[model samples]
Target: MWGLQPFYIPWYWYPCSTVFGSFFERWPLNKLELGMPRLGLLHTGIVLLLTLITELFLKQLGLDLFTTTTGPTFAAIWTTVGLGFVWQFNMWPFTELSQPTKGIVASIASLIISVFLYLVTVFLVGQENIIQGLYWWFNILWVQVFLMAPGLYDGISLWQDVPPLVEEQQPLSLNSEGR
Candidate 1:
């Protein structure tokens, strides 16, 4: 299942992007503004927490769930929902576009990107080795890096806007003052 590897990437990446990316994006807005350092830490913490919860949920569901046909279908649906609704809504909270228009655009964009990833993965690996396929597909590093991108952007933006610290004047010396 060469296709399975790409499916796995988006399956993990999109949801993290939608949920964490959306919330992290708001850190720059007035409603949820935080200092850059704090925002970075908070973003890391949130990602870790979400990853932990997801791992626990999957573990509870058992490995057999992923080995079944239902696994891929469920993953596809999950990724679609994240990209279509969650990512779009979070990415464009203050857009002037109409709701339906935004939704259609988001859905199409998400579908295209997802399909492209799937095709690329399938083409590169070509369904030769199942073990390698599983390893490549299930790698968590891709998901972590994807989720960190927005935070890194936010951090850089915040860093640039920060005012430089001014040096404090030293008190006059008693000798210099002729005490």
Candidate 2:
């Protein structure tokens, strides 16, 4: 258990720095890729384990894991994983199914969904411990979003590989040419 209190220390700094820094800059961290299918799962396990450890650390620091407000935090994590497949495919927003857009939409959509779910969870659970719950939720989801970043980008990039929707040229008939 980490000795630091839940809100006493700057919790966001470590997770935020680790999350974004490792994600975009690829700075001070591991390169997790969906291409390595086996390794990807292993990496996911490692991340989830670390999250549990952090929560336990917070608990050791006297933070209650089951407080009503924290319920939404837990829900956000569940939401992230639930949306993983759709996010990776850039398949949200049914209206844009035919559009050739990048995976940026998926990431943004995922974030919005996560936030919405968190709020809903908090509303159902209670607002007293919402901050604590959000703290945990965001930390875990941050890593999830980071891990999914590559796959999501790949899905978007995959669109570029597709040929343009141009009109097909007709083949001339052999008989017509002879005639």
Candidate 3:
């Protein structure tokens, strides 16, 4: 577990591996190695993205995302939400993007999804019990969401619906002589 500083992180997901990290990092350095500016611009851009997302709650005062709070807890929730999308799900709708771009876009997309989720939760749970409702959402319900989201997007169920094994069939012998 390295420090893996993400400007705004060490990382993990329900299904996680260094393969995702390596793919994004090694490729960027080899392909888009723009000196230290790469670090500066990339990091700064992501930080700004975080700030902008946070502003959605901070500015509104009363509004907040699916996250617990609009501070560090918000960052934690955003990271948790993005991991399943970014890693297990292969950053859908942005998979064609380069590694750096994919990471950035998918992250912001996750934050957007969080906002959407907040609205949904509020509508369903109502404002009266928001704190308890969000707690249930992030802690309990999101586990199932993480497990299924990728499969749902990819048109598969994690527990695939297929036979476990197939019986071997004898090969048909062709009689070319008859033809």
Per-structure clash totals for the candidates: 0, 0, 0
| Per-residue lDDT of model 2, residues 22-125, tens digit only | 22232112344445677546645555564556456446634344443443454454445434534554443433533223233433454455556666756765
- Model number with the top TM-score: 3
Model 1: per-residue lDDT, tens digit, 56-94? 555464422234432343344345443334433444543
Q: After superposition, how far is residue 102 of candidate 2 from its true place, in Å?
A: 2.6
Model 2 lDDT, full chain set: 0.47
Report lDDT per candidate: 0.46, 0.47, 0.49
Worst 10 residues of 3 by lDDT: 8-17
Worst 10 residues of 2 by lDDT: 20-29
Q: Rank the candidates by TM-score, best first.
A: 3, 1, 2
Error of 1 at 111 (Å): 18
Off by over 4 Å in 1: 1-14, 23-32, 63-77, 87-179
Model 1 RMSD in angstroms? 11.2
